[model samples]
Target chain A: DVKVTQSSRYLVKRTGEKVFLECVQDMDHENMFWYRQDPGLGLRLIYFSYDVKMKEKGDIPEGYSVSREKKERFSLILESASTNQTSMYLCATTAGPYNEQFFGPGTRLTVL
Target chain B: AQSVTQPDIHITVSEGASLELRCNYSYGATPYLFWYVQSPGQGLQLLLKYFSGDTLVQGIKGFEAEFKRSQSSFNLRKPSVHWSDAAEYFCASGYFGNEKLTFGTGTRLTIIP
Candidate 1:
């Protein structure tokens, strides 16, 4: 079975503070993704990484960035957090395109 | 651009009752269809996927989905609903070999015991 783990299940941060959400996968997948889920809006992609040091912006990439220094780890960074940034962040990894994706539990971020 | 739509926002069903969730997609070519379930405060889990060959696909947790090319629909069905089946279900579509998937708003299911 594939396992995807997030660094934190919940987090709280003040406005203008920096926030980092980490995700790690044990399946050695080549594609990793970050998404924010909201009620009535579903899951919106924030960023995705196809390979180490290669990142692509998703539909809603504003106010967020990503880092993929290694194959197993992908990190989402909020340079300066704001209240509007509060959301349930999810991380997913897939071994190849057109394959099933494994997701982490998710990190619920609260930006006050 | 490909898109997915899940018409029902919320559904209520009694235990042991039949269940069906509707999903439709808009894409130029043959799209990759998937159904995912997410428990409260949890990440999304793949229930099933429809790429090719078999239009009807079976998934875990006693769930199944059928793809209709004529209607551009991939509806999920379950013979018997259980209380534990309550969760948010999403329909997603993607292009072949695409890295991103377009997801629907999701339907929240409530199972009555």
Candidate 2:
């Protein structure tokens, strides 16, 4: 089965702390995405990487950054955590457009 | 810009009752529509998708959805609901194949036995 693995399932951080959430996929898919799931907001795109070292800002990329140093690994970085940034972050990978994405279990972040 | 709308924020139904979840979308071209279900604390799972061919599409877990081009709607339905079917259902649409998906606010379903 294809799996998108997230390194952390939960994390707690203080304001102004840098936090990293890692994701890896075994499918060799060319596209990887980061989204934050919130109540009444659904899942909003934060960042996505098409290929190694190539990234694009999504609708809510203001407080987030991404790293795609390897083909199978993608990382979402929080420059400085804030209370408003607390949410469930999901990572997904897919081969091409409009196709099914394999998503990781998600990481629930709490900022104090 | 392409967008999707799911008006119902929460829905409740009995285990043996029929179910229908509405979804609406706006896009310039022929859009790619999809339904995904997410259990509590879990990742989203694809329930069905419409890429063309037939307007009515069947999916796993006995869920089905019909696409109506005139109304720009893709509504999901099930003949009978099960207790385990309670979850958050999301409807999404995008113009590009294999590209980023723009999802709706999502509708949470609750099954009462």
Candidate 3:
């Protein structure tokens, strides 16, 4: 089974603070993705990394950046957290575009 | 652009009752369709997927879905509902070999005794 683990399950940060959400996959998948889930809006992609040091912006990538220094780890960074940035962050990894993605438990971020 | 739509926002069913969830997708060519269930505080789990071939697909936990090309729909169904089946279900669509998938808003399922 593919195991995807996130660094935190819940986090709280003050406005303008920097925040980082880390995700690691044991399967060494080549594709990693970051998504924010909101009520009535479903899961919206924030960023994705196809390979180490290669990143692409998703539909809603504003105020967010991603790092993929290694094949097993992917990190999502918020330049300066704002209240609007509060959301449930999900990380997923897949072997390829056509494969099913395995997801982490997700981190519920609260930016106050 | 590919998109998915789930008409029902929420549905309630008694235990042992039948269940069905509607899902529709808009895409130019043949698309990959998936049904995912997310339990409370858990990540999404793949219930089933529709790529090609057979229109009816069986999935885990007694769940199945049918793909109708004429209707552009992939609706999920279950013979009987269980308490554990209460969760949020999402329908997603994307082209084969595409990295991004368009997901529906999700339908929250509630099972009653």
Candidate 4:
């Protein structure tokens, strides 16, 4: 079975603070994604990495960035946390384009 | 662009009753369809997927989905509902080799006793 683990299940940060959400996959998937889920809005992609040091912006990439220094780890960074940035963040990984993605538990971020 | 749509936002069903969740898709060619379930405070889990061959596909947790090319629909169905079935269901679509999937807003299911 594939396992995806997030660094934190819940996090709280003050306004203008920097926030980092980490995700690691044991399957060594080539594609990693970051998404933020909100009520009635579904899951919106924030960023995705196809390979190490290669990143692509998704639909809602503003205020968010990503890093993929290694094959197993992907990190999401918030330059300046704000209340509007509070949402449930999810990380998913897939071995190939046609394969289904495996997801981590998710991190509920609260920016105050 | 490939996209998926779930018309119902919320659905309520009694335990042991039949359940169905609607999903539709728009794509240029044959698309990959998927149904995912997300429990409270949990990440999404793939319930089933429809790529090709059979139009009707069986999924885990006693769930199934049928793809209707004529209607551009891939609706999920379950014979009986359980209390543990309460969760948010999302419908998504993607291309053959596309890495990104277009997800529907999602339908939240509530199982009533």
Best by lDDT: 4
Model 4: what is its DockQ? 0.75
Residue B85's C-alpha lDDT in candidate 4? 99
lDDT digits (tens) for residues B1-113 of candidate 2: 88899999999999999999999999978898989999999989989999989999999999999999999999999999999999999998877654788899999999998
- Give me the overall lDDT of model 2: 0.93
Docking quality category of candidate 2 according to DockQ thresholds = medium
Query: Candidate 2's residue-wise lDDT over A1-112, tens digit each?
Result: 7889999898999999999999999988999999999999999999988899999999999988999999999999999999999999999987566666778999999999
Q: Candidate 4 — number of clashing residue pairs?
A: 0
List ranges where model 2 is wrong by over 4 Å. none
Candidate 4: residue A37 Cα off by (Å): 0.2
Error of 2 at B87 (Å): 0.4
Report the poorest 10 consecutive residues by lDDT, candidate 3 chain B: B93-102
Residue lDDT tens for model 4, B2-70: 778899999999999999999999986889889999999899999999889999999999999999999
lDDT of 1 at A102: 80
Q: For this target, which candidate reaches the highest DockQ against the unseen true structure?
A: 4
After superposition, the stretches of candidate 4 with alpha carbons farther than 4 Å from their true spots are: none
Q: What share of the true interface contacts does each candidate keep?
A: 0.62, 0.62, 0.52, 0.60
Error of 1 at B22 (Å): 0.7
Decreasing DockQ order of the candidates? 4, 1, 3, 2
lDDT of 1 at B45: 93
DockQ class, candidate 1: medium
lDDT of each residue in A1-112, candidate 4, tens digit only: 9999999999999999999999999997999999999999999999999999999999999999899999999999999999999999999998576858889999999999
1 against 4, candidate with superior lDDT? 4
